[model samples]
Target: MAKEKIVLAYSGGLDTSIILKWLKETYDAEIIAFTADIGQKDELDGLEAKALATGASKVYIDDLRDEFAKDFIYPMFQAGAQYEGQYLLGTSIARPLIAKRMVEIARAEGATAIAHGATGKGNDQVRFELAAAALAPEIAVIAPWRLPEFREEFPGRAEMIAFAEKHGIPVTASAAKPYSTDRNLLHISYESGVLEDPWFDASDAESKGMYLLSVDPEDAPDQAEMIELEFAQGDVVAINGKELSPLEVMEQLNELGGKHGIGRVDMVENRFVGMKSRGVYETPGGAILFAAHRKMESLTLDREVMNLRDSLITRYSTLVYNGFWFAPERLALQALVTESQRNVSGTVRLKLYKGNVIAAGVKSPVSLYNPEIATMEADPTQAYDQGDATGFIRLNALRLKVNSGVEQNQK
Candidate 1:
């Protein structure tokens, strides 16, 4: 009889590398390692060789960068989704895409089970398993960190390192500097280690070395840089008047935003699994895109429509944070969000300085702003009549007048 096959989401990282070897030894299963390339850049280099050397029977590295930007990232941005008003949902948004591809691979390879390296305590596990259950109900899901046997064998990173040495798996991990990190095109996040302390100033020398995407605000250049972004139906179509693909747009903005020290955040966020985790993130490109998108909306969207969409931001953001990307409610909400963007086409000018994205100007051909009604200067035959304010104010003040009379009577 052939051994049971399992597909493991491999990242060429310490935890996933160790999990690859452990799965082979414990289950005696044929491991098909898979890595999703969602703009991790050079991290994907030579990963196939490493997977094969680490006991994988087959290896796959899929480039999902364009899909990630076009499908996942843009839609979330269009909804103005932000977790806790700080995080851009960088790692939160990537998990569903990775899990979706893992399901596809599992079906193609005739694999019976799918595995991931997310620990039992974190939100990634929920995101991965929920997506797998929704997408492929028949396939079994394996999580080693939740098993007592696995935890007993390798209690921590130190033990995992020893196990890796015994298995002859090459790893650059060590007990020192055990800061956990997750990286992609949108952002790079650092947690655990020194960052676990909420009060630990990340700007200090010891913690500062962990940042990879952007420079420190103090080290940024003295002058600010201005750029223009063009949008069509709520999506950024061009930067500085140059049309580019979604991936190219993100790349360009990341370079420009990182140079100006934009998009750095530190906060204690509530995880889906009922814990508060301290995290430091650098989301240079995403910050710029978000600011520019909102500026464009201010010019094109109606006041009430924009307010209604804003009211749903918390719910929308929670759905993304809790791994409900495939849920029915999220789909319904996304339909409304898409409808709200129907006329959100415009240009926004912005200035990027040290740790700031400032809006300079915004304009749209479909803008509702009327200078004739807005101008304070008197016009001989203008439509506006100053006499109309008397009735408007009196009608609006009726409720307040009645409330004041009632309060006086009570006193």
Candidate 2:
């Protein structure tokens, strides 16, 4: 009989690395390590060799940066999705893509079950399982952190560190660096460690180790930098009049915005697990992109359509944050958000400086902002009707008038 094979979403981190070896020794099953490349530059270097040495039979490295930014990030940006008005869903947005690929590899490798290192308390376990359920329902999921024996074997990071040290697993976790971090092209998230205390203000918040994707606002260039961004059907297609692919556009914006210190957010937000957690995020490119995208909508999108999207942003953000990215409801909302951006073809000039993305100017071919007709300083009778205001105002005020009359009669 063929040896049972299990594929794991391997980050080559301390937890996953230990799990890889544990899976091989305990079950005597073949272990395949799969790493999704969503722009963790230095993190992926030497990962394959490390995984193989640590007990993985086969290793798969996928460069998902372009797909991540374009397919997942861009569409979420189209919806202006922000969980609790602070989190850009950086980690939330990347989870589904990684989970989907893991499922595919499981089928290709003929694996009996898939595994992840997500802790029992986190949202990632829910995300990985939900995406797997949506994409490949047949594959069994083996979450070691959720397993009784696994939890007993390694109760905390200290035991896991001892396991790695005893086995020579080339572990990276240390007592000094106790924080858990997750990184992608979109952002880097740091949790636990010194951050467990809600009031611990990150030291040197500007040039500090906290923000990787942004420069210090104090260190930002003295002069504001301007760049023109082009969009079509809600996807950014160019920067500074140079046409480029969606991926290239983000790459450029990331560099540009980072240099100017454009995006950095620190907030205490309500997590889906019914707890308030403090987090800091650096989304330099996303911040600039959202600023430009909303400016474009002001020009091209219809009032009702924009209002509908505005009302639904919270729901969309919740879906992403709660790990329901692959749900039909999310897809349905994306369809409507994309439909609303059909006429959102335009260019916006933005000046970035001191953590600010200022809309210097904007223009769209389908712009509803007609300066000639909207001018209050001058007269344009073709579109403006002075005579229509009498009934319009009276009809709108009727409810207020009736309420006042009723109150007077009671008095």
Residue 229 of model 2 has an lDDT of 91
Tens-digit lDDT track of model 1 for 210-281: 788898888888999999999999999999999988999898999988999899999999999999999899
Minimal lDDT window, size 10, model 2: 202-211
- Candidate 2 collision pairs: none
Instruction: Write one digit per residue (lDDT tens) for candidate 2, span 302-335.
Output: 9999999999999999999988998999999999
Candidate 1 has an lDDT of 0.92
Model 1 earns a TM-score of: 0.96
Clashes of each: 0, 0
Q: For every model shown, what is its TM-score relative to the native structure?
A: 0.96, 0.96
Candidate 1 residue spans exceeding 4 A from truth: 379-383
What is each predicted model's overall lDDT from 0 to 1?
A: 0.92, 0.88
Worst 10 residues of 1 by lDDT: 372-381
